[model samples]
Target: MATADGEAPRPEERQIEPLHLPTPEEIRGQDIWNNCAVRSVASGVMGGGLGFFMGMFLGALDNPIMQEEMTTKQQLIFQAKQMGRRSISSAKAFGIMGLIFSAAECVVEKTRAKHDTTNTVVAGCVTGGAISAKGGPKAACVGCAGFAAFSVAIEKFLDRHS
Candidate 1:
């Protein structure tokens, strides 16, 4: 910028940035969330919160099995119960999923010692297989492939956008 002297300020005379002191919360956040377990738990909680909302929305749109035979009050009660049940179920599922996925990814990244799509895919496969293990071997394999592909696509999309 030009001064009254019609000249730019010299580098030596330029203003320096002021020092910043982090707040307690900021310092605590970094300190407490510096581990894999903490990150996984946080992810689980966030996923559970999102799932709860999604379940509520879906439950609101769902028609009760015997809505035609119920009074207005009864139907409302039924819907409320359904919404609550759905939300709880979804929250649990999502929380477990998030915990599993985040832990797997963290472990995989640490072991591989690399930050790349390969780690994402491996972690995704592990998560998918674990989630689908109850369905049998065939189902697990399918889930592994599907989730790995999904992870790769997501990673690629974020990479391109960022």
Candidate 2:
């Protein structure tokens, strides 16, 4: 409608319709796959960084007596090399683990039944155990239990809030 000044009313002056967003269930397959890939990469980077720092801290703590015997410059150089080696190894392990775990979860969510807490827990346990199998049966079992517990806690938190 035109105002007294003979100019049309601004668009904001008109009524606006609300937008209907797609629900999670309604998301397309390609979009879901893309999301999963992106999430996996992000998880890998975060896990790698965490592992690197942890390795550095633990490495430093492991050899205090030896560190004290060395000259300051020598100790610093040795520790740097040690930390670098440990951090790189840890970063590789964590990055691979995160990538596998996230990808597995995404696959289970997309291919199996509808996404739910149960599916998430199962996926986490499976991936965790599989990844930890390199250590030993005991480690695998522990990893499975840990991941399951973590997933359950996260699910519960989300449920409570949402």
Candidate 3:
């Protein structure tokens, strides 16, 4: 059908934005970041950094055990060492915790096919149980229950705030 002097379809005549093709580099970058392993690792690293800072702050607040006997320089050195040790130890724990929680959440989300609090609770249980398994079955059960509860509370708080 022809319009008043129109040979083209109205859809075609309407303005259309030009398609933007992502470059090969952009495609590869997206693929790399979208990978599950990369995402877990990134989360672990970020968690570790947060834990490190927290540990440092807490360690700095600690009073030297022998402050009365130690010279000023000795006290400084002792505090520095304490901070470093605390930071590294907490960082390791936080990194593992983050990685496990992230991976578990991803798997739970994928398996359940939903994005909701149940996934968070399951992931928290898995992570906590796995982390505490070394303490024995009872500890693992306790950890799972406690973490699941904590996860639920956090989920509710976030949902309410959001």
Candidate 4:
């Protein structure tokens, strides 16, 4: 159809569908912080459990030697246990850092999934690398990486869907 001035009619006149983009009012109404916190905590629990299992496995490797030596062997076993505890502690640190980053991002973005995903993953990697350098690289790499990934994944999944 043509207008009275002979120009083609505007397309908007023929359209009635509403766009779905939320306005500032809607954005402000969403509670992103609470959701992220919940997600972060859930992930932390899972990560912590996995870390505990891994620590147990590492400690188990010293079992035969530990039982065989009642004197020097016992000391070695004690040292091994101490090392395992340290590794678990590092994993816990990484997990906590991931949770903090995810929660803060959620509070800032209010359901913006991308922000939290990026922050958590990057933070995890950095924490893992740092722990590796400080402790044995292999132990830190496995524990920190595993825990960080698990917790971050939890945070990302929940934030994206919710």
lDDT of 1 at 125: 95
Which of candidates 3 and 4 is the stronger one according to lDDT?
Answer: 3
Q: Count the backbone clashes (under 3 Å) in each candidate.
A: 0, 0, 0, 0
Give a tens-digit lDDT track for model 3, residues 39-70: 88998999899889988988888888779999
Q: Provide the overall lDDT of each model, using Cα atoms, as 2-decimal numbers.
A: 0.86, 0.79, 0.87, 0.63
What lDDT score goes with residue 144 in model 2?
A: 92
| Candidate 4 regions with alpha-carbon error over 4 angstroms | 1-34, 63-68, 71-91, 104-162
Q: Pick the candidate with the highest TM-score.
A: 1
Which scores higher on TM-score, 1 or 4?
A: 1
Q: Cα lDDT for residue 116, model 1?
A: 73
lDDT score for candidate 1 against the true structure:
0.86
In the range 29-143, model 1's lDDT, one tens digit per residue, is 9877757899899999998998899889877777878888989999898889888988888998888888888888878877888777777888889988988999999999998
Worst 10 residues of 4 by lDDT: 60-69
- Across residues 40-119, which tens digit of lDDT does each residue of candidate 4 receive? 78666766766666666666555445455577767776767766785587468646654655455555455444544565
Tens digit of lDDT per residue, candidate 2, span 1-114?
Answer: 798899999988877779998877778754754687887888888889888998788667555467667898888777788788888888888887777777777778777746
